[model samples]
Target chain A: MPARKSAQPAKPAPDSTRRSEKSRRAIYEAALALVVEVGYPKTTIEGIAARAGVGKQTIYRWWSSKADVLMEAFLDLGEQSLREAGPVPYAFPDSGDLAADVKAVLRATVDQLRDPRFEAPSRALAAEGVVNEHLGRELVAKLMQPSLDLYIGRLRAAQDAGQVRPEIDPRIALEFFISPLAQRWLQHTGPISYEYTDTLVDYALHGLAPR
Target chain B: MPARKSAQPAKPAPDSTRRSEKSRRAIYEAALALVVEVGYPKTTIEGIAARAGVGKQTIYRWWSSKADVLMEAFLDLGEQSLREAGPVPYAFPDSGDLAADVKAVLRATVDQLRDPRFEAPSRALAAEGVVNEHLGRELVAKLMQPSLDLYIGRLRAAQDAGQVRPEIDPRIALEFFISPLAQRWLQHTGPISYEYTDTLVDYALHGLAPR
Candidate 1:
């Protein structure tokens, strides 16, 4: 779907398929790098092409705009992250201990956040999304929703097992697990650590009032 | 401090004090209008000056940059909101009921978020802050700090009365009340309303766990 937006049908000729794959990857990496260095507004296909050492025609032949390239680039980064997170990382662990499983996932999230490759571009994209409604919704739909769905699935499982109160809406409940960390990173309000995420998980699972 | 940033020391020459006040108000309105319309990047001192129908020198005589002008305008907006909230609005109601007090303040926040005068410009500035770290921090200090301190104070009172866990960090605990709502607005994830905020209050206080 994103490639459809990119207008790149991956017309991998039966011959130049290897070359096409190389060019596509080079474009994604270059787009991510440029966005981080110069920001989204200042970045362009020309800039990405020059940086990637590919011709502008090659870029135009595939992608429609800088936004499309960047979106797909970020998606690629996320896919890479999932691959790095070990096999089946997207599948939330159901150790039948909801709190521990959530904590484990959040801790992994903490590690990914600390990873420098993701930090700068993410900040740039998130910052732009804050101002740009179209881009913001696109990010929520393309980048954020899949991960959110995974959380929803895990929470539903917890509800079925009676680990969570049946009355709670999993979508909103998931915010406690993720939004705090997201806000801290976006706002620079606090340091992120395993400790902070673990605390959020605990506070979220147990009543903050006297138990 | 903000007035200092606005560079408008109250020295209002005995003769032009009223005129000065009028000009300052016009400048604030113009700065806010321009930012909402053109966004922070395109909003210029020159544009604000043109829009306000004042000479460039008039703006130069007061604020230093577009950021300073916008900051003062936002501060003015916050003041107007407080005024509308009635006298002593800054005081979070204690009434020996933490949940009720927090809910009251959050509901007021919901109204403020929905206010047309606040929403567009606020979103514009908030979006910029996400990408611009310096502006982001300044916003937290100038716009967010006083309200945050109020939350801290009220939570401290709750802790002293043993209403909340003595070990709970109010700073972190308070996010449960606001960050989810903030994310919902910033990310376009869901609808915001008194009913939704009330649910957040209930969830954050009682928590997702069975009591």
Candidate 2:
């Protein structure tokens, strides 16, 4: 769970609950918009509050720092993306055919990356992370680590099935599936497509050298 | 060649040439420092000139814009790094054993990425490129493309030697060598070291699947 989630859940009346939900959504939208517009360094809580039509104290009430707000906002955005992708409780697909399962996940990622709502704010935050080491590590730990864990879990399953080499480090092995696509997307090195991701899966699983 | 390279070579008097060389080195240092300190958007030609103790006209005489100056500065820095690595004419070594050759190149790259002078300025520029599509494309074209080409060439050579599958696209195949390292360096996803990179080579060359 995110560190900022309230330890004691507030039990409020229906009207107050609805109002808080509305305010929270507005804050998320405002934070994402501000980061996309002004970039991360120039984005302030005051600006987010003003844009959200909420008081600064309200933002402080929920989150301790701008980083916290932005991180949570991004997490919300990712959740929204996952929900749009399908039903609740998305798990990394493990159909026993490791290649097909990984390809499906990577295809979904390509779709998420191409989403207009996710692209701009994500690029802004990712760009900041590239230069800001503290923020970069925070992004890795908070934003990316969960997905990485899923990849590692799936790989472990493949290992158990005798589909993957047991001695292989899933951590580094997983990069071949994601990093190329990421470099292409973030650096504008090449076009991203399902076919491209499928190729990554093939190359990573089967090896580039003749089998 | 970079677009800004002079079409005609200038023949200047020896004393004048020495003065120009000194001024050029100062400008390159100033541009890199400004980008690292103030970032790309805030870095101006006036700022670079002021720092370099040169007039704005001196900058305008050689480069059309700040982008040109920065790109040339980075190219110069890369050459300096290559020179420091050893004697000139650094070719991608093809020692029959493709893995050993690629590993050596990647190790040298690790050294370059860890260089104090290269790291900050490179991170600053790469961060800017992530958000700025046009600049990102330019960076890929002018800075990364040559290195990518060398990788492609080496992979092609390996294919000819039957070390790699002839059916594999060299372009995508090469990403397995570089993108993981690039992602780790740019995003702080993992610790970078010769060992980590060597492991990547082994995993990539030999399939992660039990062979």
Candidate 3:
């Protein structure tokens, strides 16, 4: 859940760029707040504008729809999360230990998932996505897919190092590690912790059967 | 999901018991249909009664809340799913090959997930559970926990037979096989298939690392 906010200003006059940035932040904050308060169905662009202290036309000038605004807002929040989480720098750390590296990333993800600021709104959007197929796809494509691609890159690196099986599909194999955590977080199926994630890394890399 | 439905008859008089059974079946069908049509929030006892061609008094006479009614209805649907699928009953097949057995069951689950009768209403209830924490816990405790216990039992059996490692937590280990499929169904992250599930079984048991 990392953000690459793409709310680019068409032309950046210095003062105007500062103004646009301010407005963008306000809109992102307001959009997330409204979605949490009213849910996806009732979260309208007008509502976001009202909460953000901007005109609906101001929102329309930037984002095409409520979905676009919320998506970018979430992206911004993810970047904010990365910033707050300190020098992690939003990239998978490769210390040449696949288990240690994956565990580090997952532990950070656990922190991100547990962060109170991210939790409620993330749940609200995720819950909405369960029933709303189109929005769900967008969530995966924009918010989730990037992180997934990163995992794929790291896993491919592991394979080249002869750490992971070369024949394994990183996409599917990655799910063995991430999906369990995702499900527990998403479905209330179980509690998540650093220990749980570390165990997942160990389990994913080693066969469950007797060695 | 297993339903140990508590929709028992107050009186056991022969004709009364027969009538109660008929009403129970009608209520289950009605509740399931209503949820799929209008979702959990809009589905009501009154609406279920109207659809099932029974009295609201009849529904209330058995179940306490819409959540109860729907949970029981789903339990019944699960049982119905079992019967239609085969005469294996609902028990996990203990063929002594843990991989083969789990693969078979997950494949069956994939089929059931795709079934028209189960798909819409299951999605409706699941979507509701995602947002409603109270309902979500009830979903896990009542509907999901029983089925999970079955998996635990099977894994434990595998442990005793030297199939699964003894130190492994069946609970977490089970997630590898189930959560991926659950996430796919809930989030539309990917398509589910027999081959996909079979691979999940294989990857889960064997590990992602090179042998």
What are the per-residue Cα lDDT tens digits for candidate 2 across B74-102?
Answer: 99999998988779576898889999999
TM-score of chain B of 2: 0.95
Model 1: clashing residue pairs?
A: none
Show the colliding residue pairs in model 3. none
TM-score of 1: 0.89
**How do the candidates score on chain B by TM-score?**
0.92, 0.95, 0.91
State the lDDT at B159 in candidate 1: 89
Q: Which candidate would rank higher by DockQ, 1 or 2?
A: 2
- Give the clash total for candidate 3: 0
For model 3, how does the per-residue alpha-carbon lDDT over A104-152 read when each residue is reduced to its tens digit?
A: 9899889989898898888889988887889999999988998899899
Error of 1 at A29 (Å): 2.0
In angstroms, give how far residue B127 of model 1 lies from its true place.
Answer: 2.0
**If both were scored by DockQ, which would come out higher, candidate 2 or candidate 3?**
2
- What clash count goes with each model? 0, 0, 0
Best by TM-score: 2
- Winning model by DockQ: 2
Instruction: Name the better of 1 and 3 by DockQ.
Output: 3
Off by over 4 Å in 2: A1-10, B1-10
- The docking category that best describes candidate 3 is medium
Span of 10 residues, lowest total lDDT, candidate 2 chain B: B1-10
What C-alpha lDDT, on a 0 to 100 scale, does residue B166 get in candidate 3? 96
